[model samples]
Structures are given as C-alpha cells and as structure tokens.
Target: MPYLTTADGAEIFYKDWGTGQPIIFSHGWPLNSDAWDVEMKLAADNGFRAIAHDRRGHGRSTSTYTGNDMDTYAADLAALVDALNLTDIILVGHSTGGGEVVRFAAQHGAGRVVKIATAGAVPPVMVKSDTNPEGTPIEVFDSIRAGVLADRSQFYQDLSAQFFGTNREGSTISQGQRDQFWRQGMQVGLAAAYDCVKAFSETDFTEDLKALDVPIFIAQGADDQIVPIDDAAMKSINLVKNGTLKVYPGAPHGIAGSYQQELDKDLLEFWLS
Candidate 1:
C-alpha cells in the first residue's frame, strides 16, 4: 500500500493517479479517500491528475488517536503537496475536508491552488458561537459524538439513512449503496470519528474563506441532514470574494454518488473555463 508520512510521522494513505493538472480531493469525516472514486476516475479520464488521501486514523492510514484536529489535517495536506511538488492544483473537499481546504489555502497561500470547491463543507463555522449567531447548536453535535462513540455500527447504519435521505418515506434506495457507505464508515477508527465530530463541528473558517481571492465554488444539496446544506456550502459562497454557488434540490449530503455525473460535468466545464 502507498503512503505518505506527515511531519508528525503519521502515515497518510493516498491514491495518486494519471498525469496532468492535479485535482486533490479531501474526504469528509469518518470516511477515507475512497469517497471520491467516481469523481477521481472522471478527472483522470478527462486529462488531469487526481489525488486523495485517507486522513490519518481513517482507512488504511495510521490509526493513532492523536493530531486529529483541523490544523493538523491541513498540515498533513500541505506535507502531501510539498512531497509531491504539485502546483496549480484544484482542491475539492467535502464536509470536514472543506474546512481543511480553506485553512490550507489561507495558511499556505493560494499560489499553488488554481481553484477550490467545498461540497457539504463546514465553513464560515458550523457551531453557534456568540460571534456567529446562525450556526448549528453545539448540543446537536455533542449528541452525534456521543452516538458515534457509544454504538459505532448502529450509529453508522442510522447515519446512512440521513446521508442518502433514505430516512424519508417513499424514497427508493439501493441496498448496495447503503451497504457500501456503512462499510466505509465502519472502516474508520471510532476514536477518530468521535474526535472529528467535534473537529468539523467547531472549526471556524471565516477568516480562511475571506483571505482567498481565488475562484471558489460551493455546491450543496438542499436536503442535506448530516451537515445542513445552507450553513455549510451556501454560507461559504457568500463569504468568499469570487464564489459560484450550485444547489441540488432534495439531494442528500452524499451528493457525490447521487449527482456524480452532474458534478463531473460541472468540474470539467469549470476547469476548461
């Protein structure tokens, strides 16, 4: 298995493929690089390099229960880019990964970043602090953290329903798709999942989003439950200087699988333009 050792000596598992301008993807909480298979293949076929890393403690990467915060996540990404010498890269992040991209772009500067997009991202902050009034309540995330640490398997299964919006009545679903998502969630470490619940929920990306003067796209599924579509992606676009917004009606948080073709077309045309 291929791996890149971060500065802190944690081995980060990653997939790097094809050749051309790079498209680096960061997966959401509790999942690995495996989250972007469809999108990665499309980018590879479309004449670009695609790279994705399983954040430390997730997937086949080192499962050490340390340094699982957003700063470390972005730092690990920086190490990966520096080690690979990738430039003009498009950073695509979903959920918590979106927070990582914003921090990485701001902390490292956007010279290496050609473009950025956050899907179901946790940006402009997710938690309702005194500073940001309209954010999600901390108690809601605390309940999630408790649920994950208590019964991971059951929690993952229940989460599957929310991610795909299968919890709703009369929504047809693929059993295989649900099973795959459950398997991915189970593959991640419980401690990592538990810690990152708070990590993603509390990360404040307002300054990071404001600092970037580059083109940004915030795509969200209006019906997202795990991470509300409005606060995560929609609010992010409003904060950035040059930002494009796209909303998928009635789509769930895992819109990558549900709307892959549409997203692929968006990326291809966005890159070409």
Candidate 2:
C-alpha cells in the first residue's frame, strides 16, 4: 500500500528497504515490482538499499490508464528517486524496464547513480526504423500489440510462456512456474498493459544508451526469444561510453529470476570491482 505521488500527481507504488548504495529495480512489461525480489533481497543482505517500483498501472499502484509512455515512465522513476533522495544508486532494469533505466539516466543524468545495468532490455530501439535497419520488424510489434488488444488475458498468458521460457532450464515446463507468471500479469490493469505493449516495442532509446556517463552493464540471455541479445544487449554495449555485456548461454528471458544465484554473484563482483 506504500506509494509516492509523482510530479504529475500519479501515485507510484514502490518498495524501499535495507541500507547502503540504493539498488533500484525497474521491471518488464505486464509484470510489477515483485519481479525484483530475489535480487533486491540479496542486495539488502549484502548491505545495499534495494527498491523496486510498480509502473503506474501495474501491481498495487493506481491503475490509471494514462501516462503509459516511455517519457512518462522515466519521469515516474525520477520522481521516486527524488522522493527517496537516493544517492549512489545502481539502477537495474529488465526487458522494457531496461529502456526505463536508459531513458531515466539520460533525462535526469546520474546525479545519484553509481552504476546502471540492463537485463534482456529493450533498447537502441526494438522495432526497426530507418536508422536501425537491423531491428525487429514492425509487423512483429504490430502483431503483438494487436494480440494484446484482441484478448488481453490470453495474449499475456501466451507471452509469459514465450518470455520467461527457454529450453535451457530444462525440456519440461513446470506448472508452478507457469502459474507464477500468470499471477504476475493478472495483477495489473489490463488497459495500462495494453498500451505498454507499444511503448515497450517501439520506444527508441539510442541517445539514452549512448549518453550514459556512469558505469553500465548488460546481461542478456543469448537464447531469449522476446528480446534478442543482438538487438538489445549487444547494441547497448556498442553504444554506452563505458559498458560491458554478459551473455548467458541458452538462458531464458527471465534469467534474472531463473538464474538468480549466478546473476547475483556476477553482479556483486561487478559492484565491488
């Protein structure tokens, strides 16, 4: 129930706990702050202040249908930073949340950020434009957007399988895993999620990635179907002034959660280094 109101009077729900350099997490489309718990708790145990916010319409936050664009997302995040007066934050984002990290850093600068990282992020543009000719096709995003509008629940359900899933974990799929994913999506405002489809798919963040002045890392699942390593992580590495890429072979899009121990270890090393 804890939430902070943004500059535009939007009530942004967030979890701010623990102590040390703040680690702010931005989650992917349709999912909320709960997505970052494993990472947040680990950081907290290691003496870091970990925070995660539910994008306006998702999770327990107010489910307003407006302000679902990338700029608004960045602004909402900035408001949380300002409200907490967070200093020395390490911003970590996944999927669409990755784009949020990039846009937030570029718009607000790293006034209190020591590092920024993206995991299976959607950046450097997701859908191919003239400048990014190698990007994902327009029809791909259009089809996804259409699918969401057509049947929000079913589309999200199918997407959960496509996104969180990869055979690398195992050939067999677990019902618990599938149910957990479904629960996360069902906890949000359907309308907000529908609009977010386009925001995440089409938002361009080339300048944002390039302008990052702080240390940045990108961990991408090589076999991820949702956001290809080449389109998001590799491209980000090439753009950021000081950036590194970590490729997780045969991992799923939800590698951040599925492969927590491995990722946490890698991240801690990076943080201390």
Which candidate leads the pack in TM-score?
1
lDDT string for model 2 (1-273, tens) is 678988777788899879888889999988899988888888889888889999988988878788998999999998888888878878899998999988998998467777988888999888888888888898997787787678867887787777766334473456566676678888778678778878998898988887888999889877788997788888889989999889887677874454556777888777766
lDDT per residue as tens, model 1, 11-34: 999999889999999988778888
Top lDDT hit:
1
TM-score of 2: 0.94
Q: TM-score per candidate, in order?
A: 0.96, 0.94
RMSD of 2: 1.8
Which ranges in model 1 have alpha carbons more than 4 Å from their true place? Answer: 256-258
Q: Which stretches of candidate 2 lie over 4 Å from their true place?
A: 166-169, 256-258
Residue 175 displacement in candidate 1 (angstroms): 1.7
